[model samples]
Target chain A: MKKKNDWPFILPAIFVVAVMTQVPFLLTVVYSTLRWNLARPDMPIVFSGIDNYLFFLKIPDFTVVPEFYSIVLQTIIVTVVALVICTVIGFLFSILLDHPIPGVNIARTLIMGPFFVMSTVTGVIWKTTILNTTFGWYGVLAKSIGLAPVDLLSYYPLPVIIFLFCWQWIPFFVLIILAGLQGISGELVDSMRIDGLNWWQSTFRVKLPLIMNHIRVAVMLGLVFIVKEFGLILVTTAGGPGTRSYTLPYQVYMQIFSASNVGRAGALATMTVVLTLLAVNFVSKSMKKNNL
Target chain B: MRANQTLSLQRTAQIKKVIKMVALTVTIYTLAILYFSPILYMLISGFKTEYQAVSPSFVFTPTFETYKSVLSDPSLYGYLGNSIFQVLASSVLCLLLGLPAAFALAFGNFRKKGTRDKIYMWFLTTILLPPVAVLIPLYTWFHAWQLNTTPLGLLMAYVGFHVPIVVWMLYSFFADVPTEIMEASEMDGCTRFQQMMHIAVPLVRTGIISACLLVAVFIWNEFFLGFNLTGNDTATLPVYMSRFREQQGMFIAQLSASSTIAILPAIVVGWMTQKSLVKGLTLGAVKG
Candidate 1:
C-alpha cells in the first residue's frame, strides 16, 4: 500500500488554527511581560518581571467597585449560583418530560428558547423588559398588587444576573440529563420496579449512578461557560453602582477597552486562560477515563 | 363477589391513570410558562407603542409601528448585511478548513498511533479559553496590523471561533462511518479522499448541515468578538441591538423590535435543526 501522508490534507486547518489561536496564545504570555500600554507609548518598552501580574492582583487604585478580590469572589458566586439553579430546575424539568405527555414537543421548544437567544439580546431582554424595575413586567405586576416594586438588579445584581445566566443554560442541562436518562436501559428500570423499588429509590440508586457522568459533563461545561460570560455584564450592569456585578471577565474587558491598561488586561486575560484550561482539562480527563 | 372485586380494581387503576395524566400536563405546562415568559414578554414588547412598551399591559391595542420603524431604519439593513456576510463566510470557511482536518483525524495514518489524538486534543484546548483571553491579545495584534474593525478581521475571528466546533462535530460523524466501507473502498481502488468524498461525506450530510446551522447561530449572535473587534460598519446584529438600547434609552419598542428581527433567523434555524444541534451540544451524545 502506498503510504500517503495525511498531513497534506490537514495543513490548511493547522495553518488557520495556528494563525488564529497559537500566535495569540503565545502573544498573551509575551505581552504580559512588557508594559505595552498604547495610551503611554512614550514609556520605553522594558521587561517588568511580575509587575503586570502584581498590579492586576493588588489593584492599588479602587476605580472600579469591589476591586480585585471582590471581582474574583463575585465570579465564583454567580457561576456557582447559576449552576445550582440550572441543575435543580433542569433535573425537575427532565423528570417532568420523562412521561409520555401531549404537547411535549411544544413544551420542549419553549424550555429551550433561551438557548437560541443571543447572549447580548439575553442581557437586553432581561435588563429592559424583565428586570428593569421601572417599566418591567415584574414592576408592573408588583405595582398592580399594591406592593413596592422590587428592583431586582439594583438590590440583588449577582442573583439577578445569575438568574439570567441560569435562564440561558437551564435548557442545556435539561437536554443533557434527558439524554442521559434515555440512555439507561428500559429493561433495567422495569426489573428494578419488579424488584420492589419505588420511583425515588430507583432514581437515586440506579438512575443517578448511571447518569453521573452526564451530570458531571454538564457541570464542567457550565463552569467553562460561566468563566467566559462577559457580554451579559457588559450590556446590563457594566459593573456599576459599587462593583456589585463586577466579574473577572468583565474586568478584563474594562481594563483593555475602557481604561487602556494593556499590562493589567493581559494579566487578567492570563488568569482567565488558566482557569478555562483547567476546566477543559478536567472535562476531557473525566471523559477519557469514562470511555476507557 | 369475584366480579365485584375485579370491577373495583379496574376503577382504582382508572382513577390512577387520570391523576397521572392531569399531573403530568400541569407540571409540563407550568415549567414551559416559567421558562418562556421572559422571551414571550420580549416579543410582546415589540408589538406595543412606546408608552405601552414602558407600561406592560394585556389589554392594550397591539401595534406594528415599532416594527415598521425598525425595519425601515436604513442602518438596520446594514447591520443585517454585516451579520449575513460574516455568518455565511465563517460557516463556509469552517466547513472548508475543518472538514479536511476532521477527515485527517478520522482516517489519517501517522508515524505514531497517538499523533492524531495529540493534535486533536490541542485543537479542543483552544476552545477552553474565553474569547476575551484571545481578544485581549488578538485585538492588540490586529490593531497594530490595521486589521481590527474590518470585516476581514471579523471574518477571520469568526472562522477561528467556529472551526473547533465544526471539526469536533464532523470528526465524530466521520468516525462513525462504518470501517467496513473504508476497507471495501480501499479494496476497490478508491483512494481515501475519494472514499471521503463519495461515502463518508454523503453519509454525514446531516452532521454537516447541523454544524453549519450551529455555527451560523453562534456567529449571528456573537456579541463580544464583534463588539470589541468590529465597529459600526462591520458589527453584527447583537452589537447593533445593544447600540439601540444604549442610544435610544427609553425606546423599548424599537430595541425589542430590532431584537426580534435579529433573533428570528436563529430561532428558525433552531427549530430546523433541533435534534442534531442538541446532540452536538452534548458532544455527540444521541439519546437511544
Candidate 2:
C-alpha cells in the first residue's frame, strides 16, 4: 500500500525524534560555547568561544580524581571490567542452563530476577542492606560468627559499585548468549560427536563460535548502557569517598547541580559525548568488520 | 573377558553422567539463590522491626509495620499510579507515532535500501546516545517552557526516547506481515490506515504487545530523564523513590517496602515478556 512517497507517513516521528534528540545535542554544543553560570550573577552570559572546552581540556594531570580526563578513564575501566566479568559469568550460566538439568525451569526464572530490578533499588538494596557495615546482612552473619564487619562502602566503594553493576547486568549477557545458544541446531551437537569432540571441546569450539555475534552484541550493548550508570551511582556512593568512585556521568551531574557551572557542564558533556562517540565508532566499525 | 570389560566401562560412564547431572542441578540452584539473595534479603528486612532490620538479624519476629506505614502514605500510591499512567501513555504514544513510520520503512517502495538503512541507523544512534548530553539542554528548554514538571512534556520525552525501539521492533513485525495480504486489502479499496488496523495489526499482535512491554519497562525504570524532568504531579515512581531515599533518616524497612512496590509490576511484566524482551531490547537484531 506504500506509495512512491511514503515519507509523509514517517515525517511526524522523524520530526519528534529530531526535535527531542538532535536539537538538544546541537543546543548542548551551543551551550558549551557560552559562559552561562546561573550561580555567579556577577558574571553575565557571554560568548566564551572555545574557552569552555579548554576548561576541561586544560586539566594538567591524568591521575586526578573527579577530573574530566580521569573520570573518562575511570568510567571506561569500571564499565569494561564490569562488562568483562559479567560476560564471563553470564556465559558460564548460559552454558550451564544449555544442558537439560532437572528443575532448570524454576532456576532460570530466579536467575533472571535481578535483571528486572530497578537501578535505584539495586543500589539502595546493596548499600543499605547488603553492604551496610554495622547493620548489613553480612554484618549480622559475621557478628553471629564472632567476627568484625568491615565497612565495604567506606573502604571499597568502587568495587561495590562494580559488583552492583555486574549483579544487575550479568543477567543481560545471560539473556543474549542463551538466546544464541538456543538458536544452535541440534545437528551441530550431533556432528560434535562425529568429529570426536569432547563436551568441553564442543562448547568452546562449536557453541562459542556460533554465539560470537551475540557476545559482541552483549559487549556493545554493555558499552551503550554502562556509560549511563547514573542512578546506581547516585544512590549508592554518590561518587563519594573523595571521588574515588566517580564516573564521567557522575562528574557531569556534579558540575551541574553541585557547582552550578553551566558552561563547564556543557563543555564536560561535549567531551563525554566525544569519548562515547569514539567507543561507538569502534563498536560500529568492529561490528561491520565482523560482518555482524 | 572382553564383554565384562565393556560392561564395566559403560556402567562407569553412566555413573559419571548421573554425577554431572546432579552437579549441574546443584550449581543452578546455588547460583539462583545467590543471584536473588539481595531481593530476598530486602523482602525479609521489610518484615523486620527497625532494630532487627538494621541489625540484619535472622532470628527476629516478622512484622508488617513498614509495609503498613509506607502503604498508608497516600502519595506513594499517587507516584506509583502516575508512573503506571505515564508508562501506559508513552507506550501508546510510541505505537501511534511509530507504527506508520515502521510500516512505511518495511513495505514502502523506496528506491534505495541504503536510504532506509541509514534512516533506521540514525534512530538507532539516538537510542544509544548518552542521555546526559541532552540533559542540560532539555532541562533548560523544559524550564523555559514551564514544561519540565508537567506530565505532558514528560510524556513527549518518554515517547521520543522509546519510539526508536517501537519503530525497529514493529518494522521487523510489519515486515513479516505477508505483502499479499496488504495487496489484497488494497485491492478491496482499503486505505493504508485500514490495512494496518484491520489486517497487519491483528496478524502481528504479539509483536506489538511485546514492543510495548519492552518500551514500558524501559520507560518505567528510566531515572535521569524522570529525575530531572518531573516534579510533584508528574513525579515518576523512580524519582519519588529517590526523594524518599534522600530524606533524613535511614529506614531500610520502609525503603525496602517502597522498592518492592515500585519493582513489583516490572517483575510481572518482565516475566511475561521474557522471550520478546530479547527481541525488543536488541531491536529484533537478536531473537529468542
Candidate 3:
C-alpha cells in the first residue's frame, strides 16, 4: 500500500511529461528515418533509412563543403563566443554590482532589464533603433564623424548576433553568479581584507574559486538556451546575407517551413539535440575538472 | 606635537575615503545608465511621434498619441489576449501537475531504492532537450488535427514543456520541508493530500509563487514553438513583434509602443521572481 501510493502521486506528471516531451522526441527520431515531404503529397511516405541524415552530413566536395556544415559552425561560433563573453563580462558586472554602494539595487535592476524582454523584441529594437543604417543611432553617429555606416547585420552577422546574445544573456549570468558572491560569509571577506591582499588577488584567487559552481550553473543554463536561440536571428537577419547567420534552430525552422521537407528537418532536429547534449557534457566535465 | 600630527593624518584619511566613495558611486551609476541606454531609449521613443523618432535624439516632446494609435489596433488585442490566456492557463496547469509529483519524489515511498532519483533525473534531462527535438512531431500532429487553429494546442505544449521546470524548482522547496511534520500529520490519520495541502503548501508557498511566475514569464516570451505551432489567430506576442521586422526602421514610435506593451508584463513578473529564481535554480542544479 505504501509503495502503491507513490505511483499515484507521480503518475500524472510522468504521463503528461512523457506524452508531451519524451514521446514527441522519440517520434522525431523515428521521423528522421522516413522520406516524407509535406509539399509533395503525391509521393508516398516511405522508409529512407539515414538518407535524411546524410543529406546534411555527407561531404561529396571537400573544396566548398555544405551549407549544413556552415550553419553548424555558425551555431557553434555564436554559442561559444557569446557564452565565453557572458561569463567573463557577467562576472565583472557581478563584482561591480556586488559592491555595497547605495542605490545598488537600482543599478542591478537596470542591468537585468534586457534578460526579461522577449528576444524578438530585442532583435527588432536593436535592428531598427540602434543598428539601422540611415535612421538609427549607428547611422547618425557615423554620419556625424563623416564615415559611411556599414550595415552590421549584413556585413558582420555573426559578431552582431554574438554581441546581442551576450547583451541579453550576460545579465542572467550575473544573476546566478552574483547570488554566489553574496553567499560568501562575511568572515571570509573580512579575512581577505585583513590579509591586505590586493583587489586582484582577493577577487581572482579566493572569491572566484568559491563561486566556481555558480559560474558552472550559469554557463550550463546559458549554453542550453543560447545554442537553441532562434527568435533573435529570425527577426534580425532572418538568416539572410546568404545564410551567414543561420543557427541550428533557424536551419531546422527553414527545413520544415521553407523547404517543407519533414524528414530532413527531423534529421536536423535530432542532430541538434545530439550536439546540445555533447556540448553540455563537455561543459560539465570541464567545470568538474576545474573544480578539482 | 605627536597628538596634533595624528589628528591631522586621520582627518585627511577620512576626506580621502569620502572622495573614493563619491567617485565609486558616480562610476557605478554611469556604467549602469550606459548599459541600460538601449531599453531606456526604447521607452523614451515610445513617447515620441513618428517624425520625432526618425532621428536618434533623446530629447522629445512626450505624447500619448502613438500609444493611443498602437493600442487601438484590433490585431494587437488578439495576440495580447492569447499571451495572457496561455500564461495564466499553462502556469496553473503546471502547478497542479508538478506539485504532487515533487511532493512524491521528495518524500513519498518508492518500491525501488533509486526510483525517486531516477524519475527526478529524467525530468531534469527533459529540461535540457531543446524544443526543436519535439518540434517536428508536434507540428505534424497539430497540423493533421488542425490544432493550431485554436489556442488550446499551444497552451498544452506550454504546460508540457514547463511542468518539468516547475517540478525541478519545487522539488528542492519540497525537500526543505521537515519530514517530521509530514510524518506527524500521517500519524494523525491525515491523507496525503491533506498533509500536502495543510503542511507542504504553506511551507513552500513562496517557491510555488516563484515557479508560477517563472513559468508565466517563459510562456509569455516563448517564440520558437509558439511561432511554429500556432496559426495567425492563435499566435502570441512574440509573433506579433516578429511582424515588425520587415518594417525596415519605419513606424518607430508604433513599434516601440507595441513592444513595450508586449514586454512590460514579462519584465515585471520577471523582476518579482529574481530572488527565488536564484535560490531555486542554484539549489536544484548544484545538488544534482
Candidate 4:
C-alpha cells in the first residue's frame, strides 16, 4: 500500500495554530525579558534580563507584603475554593439529578443555564440584580427581616467571586459527573444494591471511585478556565477595594492596558501561564495517585 | 393470616417508596429553580418597565417596553452583528481547519512513532493556554498591521484559539469511527477525502453537530479576547455586557433585556451540547 502523506491534511491547522498561538506565546516570553513600555515610547526597547519578573517577585520590605503576592494568594483561594465547592455540591446535584424521575430533564436544563451565559453577563447580572444592596433580592430580603444589607461585592469580594464562580461552574461539573454516574452499568448498581450496600457506601465507596475519571476531567477543565477568568472580576469588583479581588489575569490586563507597561504585563502573563500549567499538572498527578 | 400480614407490610413499604420519590422530586425541582433563579429573574425582568424592575419584586405587570426599546437602540446592533459574525465565521473556519487536522490525527500515519499522540497532546495543551498569554503579541501585531480596526483581526484570533477546541472535540468523535471500515474503503479505491467526507463524517454526525454547537457557545460567551482585541465598532456582545457595569441599579430593565439577548443563544446551544459534551471531553481523556 502506498503511504499517503498526512502533511497536506494537517499543515493548515499547524500553520494557523503556530502563527496565532505558538509564535505569539514565544513573543510574549520574549516581551517578558524586555523593558518595553507603551506609555514611555520614547525609551528605547532594550533587553532588561529578569527585571520584569523581579518586579513582581521581589519584596522591598519584609513587613509589607507586595500586592502581587496577595493577588496570587487571592487567585489561589478563589480557584481552589470554587473548585472544591463545585465538586462537592455538583456531585450531590448530579446524584439527585441522575434519579429516574419524571420532568427531571426540565430541572437539569434549568440548572445548566448559567454555565452557558457569558462571564461578563454573569457578573453584571449577579452584581446588579442579585448582589446590589439597594435594589437586589438580597437587599429586599434583608430589609424585610429588619436587617441591613451589607455590600457583599465590596466587603467580601473573594467570597462573592468564589460563590459566583461555583454557581456558574457547578452545572458543568454536574453535567460531566452525572454522565459518569449514568455511564455506570446497571448490573453493577444492582449488584451493589443486592449486596446490602446502603446509600453512603454505594455513593462514596463504589460510585465515587467509578466516576473519579470524570471528576478529574471536570476539575482539570474547570481549573484551566476558572484560573484565568477576567471578565467576572472586571465587571463585578473591577479588582477594586484596594486590589483585594484581583487575580493574575486581571492584574495582567491592568498592567498592559492600564499601566501600559508591556514588559511587566508580558512577565505577568508568562507567570500566569506557568502557574496555570503547574496547577493543572499537580491536580492531574494527585488525582492519578488517588485513583490508584 | 401470615399472607395477609405480608401483603399489608408490602403495601406500607410501597407507600413509603412513593412518598420518598415525591419528596425527592420536589427537592430536585426546588433546587433547580433556585439555582436558576438569577437567570430566570433576569429573563422575567426583561419584560418589565424600568420602574417595575426598580424594586426586584416578582409580582408586577409585565411589559415589552424594555425589550422594544433595547432592540431599537442603534448601538446594540453593531455589537450584536459583530458577535453573530464572529460566531458564524469562526465556527465555519474552525470546522474547515479542524476537521481535516483531526481526521489526519486520528487516521493518518506519520513518519515517527508517537507522532499522533504528540500532535494531539500539543492541541490539548493549546486549549489550556489562556488568551492572556497570547494577548500581548496579538495586540501589538494587530496594532502594527492595523488589524484591530477591522473584524477580521479578531476573527482570526478567535479561529486560532477555537480551532484547537474543534480539533480536540472532533478528534475524539473521529476516533469512534472504526478503522476497519476505512481500510476496507481504501481497498475499494475510496480516497482519504471520500472516506472522511462520506464515511467518518456521517458516522459521527451527532459529534459534529455537538462540537459546532459547543464552539459556538464558547465563542459567543468569550470575553477576554473580545474585550481587549476589538475597537468600539468591532466589539462583541460580551463587551456590551461589560459596559452595563456602569449602569448599577439604574436601567435594570434595559440591562436585563440586553443581557437576555446576549445569553439566550448560548444557553440554548449549551443545552443542546450537554449530552455529547461529556462524551467528547471525557471519553478521549479518561481512556488515555
Among these predictions, the greatest TM-score belongs to: 4
**Residue-level lDDT tens digits of model 4 in B96-142:** 99999999999888888799899899999999898889999988887
Q: Which one wins by lDDT: 2 or 3?
A: 3
Cα lDDT tens digits, model 3, B1-288, are: 999999999999999988988888888899889888888888889999999999999987799999999989999999999999999999999999999999989888888889999999999999999999999999999989999999999888888899999999999898788889988888898888888898899999999999999999999999999999999999999999999999888999999998899998988889888999998899999878
lDDT of 4 by residue, A1-292 (tens): 5577787888899889888998999999999999999888799999999999999999999999899999999999999999999999999999999998899999999999999999999999998898888888899899999999999988999999999999999999999999999999999999998999999999999999999999999999999999989999999999988799999999999998989888999999999999999999999999999999
Q: For all the predictions, what are the DockQ values?
A: 0.63, 0.61, 0.81, 0.85
TM-score of chain A of each: 0.91, 0.93, 0.98, 0.99
- Model 1 docking tier (incorrect/acceptable/medium/high): medium
Question: Candidate 3, which segments miss by more than 4 Å at Cα?
Answer: A1-4
All models, RMSD in angstroms: 2.8, 2.6, 1.2, 0.9
Q: Considering only N, C-alpha and C atoms within 3 Å, which residue pairs clash in candidate 3?
A: none
lDDT of 1 by residue, A1-292 (tens): 5487888777888788778877776777777887877788797777887888887576556785436778878888888788878888888778778777888888888888888888888888777776666677777778779989776767878877888899899888987888778778889978997899988988877887787777776777777777788788878777766788988788888889877778778888888788667756776577557644
- Per-model TM-score versus the true fold: 0.94, 0.93, 0.98, 0.99
Scored against the native two-chain complex, candidate 3 gets a DockQ of: 0.81
lDDT of 2 by residue, B1-288 (tens): 999999999999999999988988898899888888888877777886676666665577889988899889998887888798889999998988888888877766576668787777787777777888888887777767889667888888788788888888888777667889878888999877777788888988898898888889888899888888876877888887666545323688888888888888887798788887675555456432
Report how far residue A176 has shifted in candidate 3, in Å: 0.2
Expressed as tens digits, the lDDT of each residue in A101-129 for candidate 3 is: 89999989888989999999999999999
Candidate order (TM-score) = 4, 3, 1, 2
Sort all candidates by DockQ, best to worst.
4, 3, 1, 2
- As for DockQ, the candidate ahead, 1 or 2, is 1
lDDT of 2 at B183: 80
Q: Pick the candidate with the highest lDDT.
A: 3
- Which residue pairs of candidate 2 clash? none
